[model samples]
Structure formats: C-alpha cells, structure tokens
Target: MKFLASFLILTMLTITNSITAQNQNTATKTITVTVVNATSDTGKIGFALYTKDNFMRKPIQGKEGKIKNGKSTVVFENVPSGEYAITCYHDKNNNDRMDFSKNRMPLEDYGASNNVMAFAPPTFENAKFLLKDKNLELDIKF
Candidate 1:
C-alpha cells in the first residue's frame, strides 16, 4: 500500500509540473513590426525593441529586415507580457547605422512604435505598448 501511494503521488507531481511548464511556454508571445513608408528598398531596415528601463539606451532585442514595396517587417518572438517600444530606421546607405548630419540631425528616415513625429527624441511613455495574452502588430511610417 505504501509503494502504491508513493507512485501515485509522484505521477501527480510530474503531471502538474508538465502542465505548469506548458502554461509558461504559452505565455510568451510574438510581436510583428512593419515599417510602412520606407523611401526606397535600397538597404535593410534596423529595428530595436526596448523596455522602459532601457528605453533608447540599449535595446533588449534587435532585428533587421529587407524592404519590399516600400515596406519592411520584423518579428520579435518569445516576448513576455510587458510594456515595450520599438524604433526603426532605414539604413539607406547600408552602413548599419542611422546617418546624421553635422548639426546632429538625422539624415536617414526613422520612426517609433507609435509613429511619433516630434522635434525632440521619443520617450518610453509616448511609444510604449502592452504585450499581453495575444500577439501584436504595429505599423509605423517614416
């Protein structure tokens, strides 16, 4: 009787652990970012995903995609439910960085997650979006 009870308890524990692990796996979701108005398909589009703590300083994730029909798309996978912002720039010269003029103005086209166009730099509050139970898609124009 003791052996049978121990086996049943172990089996229940294993099943419960497996269910918890599966739930955790399903909690993470994907985010799709699309740059809608790239000037040309000359070079790759660079995308950066930022959390509030590291907004505009260092991106937690980064991706690059080629432009097609004046649009570029990137997918960020396995993003847990939280607030995130995105910034993307058209690397028109294929230099892997946004170009800047001598006066410190950006030469390359750039955009934020909320399509914010401002004289000053974008902030986390202005560009942040919540990633909850479902996947998200954003269209930003530059």
Candidate 2:
C-alpha cells in the first residue's frame, strides 16, 4: 500500500531527526583552563566556573592539579557546550575566599575571563567565553 509506505518513510525520517537532535544536546565537551601567575600550591588555589548570571556552576579541584609557583590548570570534564566565565583567586590565607581591603579592593590578585578588568568592579561580560570542544588558555596576574 502506498499509504503505508509513505507513513513508514515519514516515521523513519522523524525518528532520525529526533536522534540527531538528541545527540547534539547530549554531547559532552571538555574545557581546559590554564591559569598563570598563581602564587599558591595548586590545591590552595580556588577556581570556579560561573554562568553569565554570576551563579557558580562548578568548582575546580586542585587534586586534579596544583598551581606551581605561579601557574595551574583546571579541566572541566563533560561540560555541556555553552558559554561560561572563569574566576580564580589564590587563597593564600586559606580563608576559602578572596580577602578584600577595607576599601573593598581585592587584597589578593584575581583574574577573570578575557582578563576583563578595571579599577572598579568587573562585570561578567568581561570574562565570557564560548566553549566548543577546544582548550582555552587564560592568564591571571596576582
């Protein structure tokens, strides 16, 4: 029956399209971030990936790596491909947070994406990056 044949072909095409879309949505992407100018041991350094809204998406582990005299790396595993911003600080005092001066100035050096920085507070847009299955290197100065 031609009707049955046409129906079967349409169903197969629909299923194929669905499978393609699912694969695209579920593919995992690896993003490697190499930090420079860090002064603390790798584990002591704090690194976090954030969404454009500034909410913490994930925290990077130092066990996977450690910052040398002034360098470190974090490989975000299986991250869904998307836009993200990186912020890292050396917790020299192990306070688990960046210490700021009484004037709200960052006592310890900090780095953001694209190194977007200013005398005033930096915005998330300054550090945005498009991740698409490739390694991105960023430099931070402390």
Task: State each model's CA lDDT, in order.
Answer: 0.92, 0.69
Best by TM-score: 1
lDDT of 2 by residue, 43-116 (tens): 46677777776544443322233668678777766777778777777777776777898988888767766776
CA lDDT, candidate 2, residue 142: 45
> Which residue runs of candidate 2 sit more than 4 Å off their true CA positions?
1-10, 40-43, 55-65, 133-142
Candidate 1 segments exceeding 4 Å error: 1-26
Candidate 1 lowest-lDDT run of ten? 115-124
Error of 2 at 98 (Å): 0.8
Q: List the residue pairs that clash in candidate 1.
A: none
